[model samples]
Target: MRKNERLKGKTVVITGASGGLGEQTAYRCAASGANLVLLSRNVKKLEEMAESIREKYGVSSLALKLDISRHEDIPAVFRAIFEKAGHIDVLVNNAGYGIFAEAKDVTPADVEGMFAVNVVGLIVCTKEVIPSMRKRKSGHIINISSQAGKLATPKSSVYSATKHAVLGYTNSLRMELAGDGVFVTAVNPGPMATNFFDLADPSGNYVKNLGRHILSTEKVAEKVVDAMLTNRREINLPGWMNAGSILYAIFPRLVERLGKKAFFKK
Candidate 1:
């Protein structure tokens, strides 16, 4: 590590650390010299990544089996984390997924499943770290929201709802912790080149239509790691898309009327 000082000695806990943005963000944190608590259901892969990080970056890491959707498991998992790490410096609630389907086609199971991991589970994880962070009056909670949160489109109603909830929660949490030094941030990224589309757009039509608009997980992860420990409010990816979101916010009906075709790409 050669004492990178950036996040050296900082304990960063990242959920969904087995792959996708979670995995990429972990590497960025390691490269920045942060000790890691990598949580995901894939213990084997997590351990392999931990070993790789230790060997490559000379930073210690703990790969824990955590299925964030299983809310009951979170408390015990976080207990083990605090016991081992003594205290957490940052918490990244990145364990989430989505499926693209029209509102009429979406099932109750789909809604329940996505909310379990994307919204409820994130809240549980954030809650687990609050007392510790508040007690120390120092920490950061970064919620991995999505650009879909800002602009709802066709065939993604449920997914957008979840991300919207994340943004709402993140905003309220940041305000609530104002007296405390703990900071909260929301990362709103557009679609990315990851297995997320494997499920979100199983038919592949959406990703095909998205084309170059799809972001690289590495790019999004770098932006996220760069904002670590800072009181950054939001990290929205792909300036153009975020700009569209801004436009959508003010003239929702106009954007919807004009973007009907683009919104139906799903």
Candidate 2:
């Protein structure tokens, strides 16, 4: 496949697509000739992006207002998308957020909110598409997990837990669907240069401390767009960070002892 041409003529559904990596990936996919269904709570912004891509890339797109936490509303939103796109070829579960705070300060509400969007919402969307994809024997499900899922950090307890759940879910889902020709992937990236920290680290301390190490949303989105329609298993950004995660997975105690200062950056 040529650069930026892998997803040509495919129908892609992206959640939280009004901003962050999700939005960037949508634009890149459109540039590659894919029709799009962009879902997010920010309907105004989503509509603007869809119209802009239609003009610039000449690709058809739809902006659907949705909050996946409202599980009851998910089925209907997807039904409307299928009505227009016929059938989805790719589903990117890229909608999630985090709050950075010490565990003792974390509230029940925070835990509930994060899990609702990060874990349950992703599973619900995946469930909605699996049946049709299985019937057709072809599809791609990309879950936007995080480095926190692999290596738990000081202030990322709840967020990391949710991502861990995503990893487990994606791994098992991949095994079950491999015979059906559905490719499942998990994207684990470290901090990013995005407004994600606007809410995640409202104090701005985390971003300030982790400057330069933060990954670029556009670059990461390009990687994601490039991996579409392929048998890729995982897209872990910034080789160095993923290396640390691999070490942590193998030598938990030793890495934890040696990385205490770094882990407390937040």
Candidate 3:
């Protein structure tokens, strides 16, 4: 198959799609000739994004006001997509939030909320879509994890934990579904200048340090669409970030020390 054949006429579902990486990905997917199902808590923004994609790329698109954390709302959303698009060829679990706090300082509610949206919501959405994929025997699931997914962070302990869980979860699911012709890949991105930091604990200082190294969401979005079209097992954009993952894997203590020093300088 040619490079773009993989994504042609495919229908992709993207959560937290109103802004940041999701919005940009939707536009790119449209350019690639893919139909889109954009979901997020912000309906107005999703609608505007859908209009832009439709006008610019002439691709069919829909906007759903979805809160990923709400488990009960998933089936209806998928049902609407199936009714309109027949099947979901790709599911991008990109809806996530961050909480910058010490392990002790972050509340139980904070931890729960992060997991609810980051982990639980992703699993629920995947579960909702998996049956159809199994029947078709073809689909792609891309989990948008963080660099913190592969390593622990200091102030952002809870946020890191959720991403770590996502990394492990995606890996395991990829193995289980490998023989079935369904592909699962995790996109572990480093810091990006998205609303992820804005959603951090308002009183927390976690984002201040991270903002210095943030990548452009549009750049990351481009990588995401390219990965989907190529059926890549996993992809880390901007090169150096993947190298950091290698270094962290080979020298845990060195990475831990660097992480601590970077976030908590004396």
lDDT of 2 at 264: 84
lDDT of 3 by residue, 87-206 (tens): 899999999998776788989889889999999999999998888888889999999998878766677788988988999999999998887788898998887777676667464355
Give the per-residue lDDT of model 1 (tens digit) for 27-70. Answer: 98999889999999999999999999999989989999988889
RMSD (CA, Å), each prediction: 1.6, 1.3, 2.7
Instruction: Give me candidate 2's TM-score against the actual structure.
Output: 0.98
TM-score for each of the candidates: 0.97, 0.98, 0.92
Runs in model 2 lying further than 4 Å from the true structure:
none
What is the number of backbone collisions in each predicted candidate, taken in the order shown? 0, 0, 0
lDDT of 2 by residue, 117-153 (tens): 9999999999999999999999999999998898898
What is the TM-score (0 to 1) of candidate 1?
A: 0.97
What is the lDDT of every predicted structure here? 0.93, 0.93, 0.83
Q: In terms of TM-score, how similar is model 3 to the real structure?
A: 0.92
